[model samples]
Target: MADTTNRLAGIAYLTVDGTNYMLAGDFAYSVSKVARETLMGQDRVHGYSEKPKQGSMSGSIRDAGGLSVASFNAMTNVTVTVELANGKTIIGRNMWTVGDLEVKTTEATFEVKWEGFSVEEA
Candidate 1:
């Protein structure tokens, strides 16, 4: 088995059916403050713009079950919410076909980056 301690902040790709997908994105415990803050909404407003904008909202990754499992089934659709420390939640859906499940892990955390999904507005 892979030690999984050196995979921090690395991204893994999974092949689902005939499509290539991101199986997971490992978020390191040592993630940059900017990234953590952006993911957690501690920092918002990249700078005010008079024009309208389209972009991802700030929030943290959340799950009702939390981070317990390391692998997910192929041809599966998973919805995981990243909850900002501020209590705001962003939902992401992963739709994939059945294939060899892949993951990138660290001693602290692991992730399956799901492709073919969209982020729902909070």
Candidate 2:
């Protein structure tokens, strides 16, 4: 199952007011537009159109700049711990700031092990 397609894709057309959250089995990414069918006139003339929406893909990792977010906006000096189904855990610290990742998620099992340092405005 580890090598299987155990991933999820989702979009978060985020704004200053709301926060969108998605739980995926694997990796997540964002997209530009969403297509929809529109009708016009007396006839149900359906047409495809685009909208400002988000999308997720399997085995896709996005960067923060791609998401149009600043590094300072995200958490800094953080540590991550990944736990596989085999009951083994892998820990990484100072890997990158939150601003480095466009999308980040922590599963119920693989928790944020610890934090060594944090960002501060000087």
Q: Cα-based RMSD of the predictions, in order?
A: 14.7, 15.6
lDDT of each: 0.35, 0.32
Q: Largest TM-score belongs to which candidate?
A: 1
**Prediction-by-prediction clash tally:** 12, 1
lDDT, candidate 1, equals: 0.35
Q: Which ten residues in a row have the lowest lDDT in candidate 1?
A: 27-36
Instruction: Give TM-scores for every candidate, taking all chains together and pairing residue i with residue i.
Output: 0.32, 0.25
Q: Which residue pairs clash in candidate 2?
A: 7-26
Question: Could you say which candidate leads in lDDT?
Answer: 1
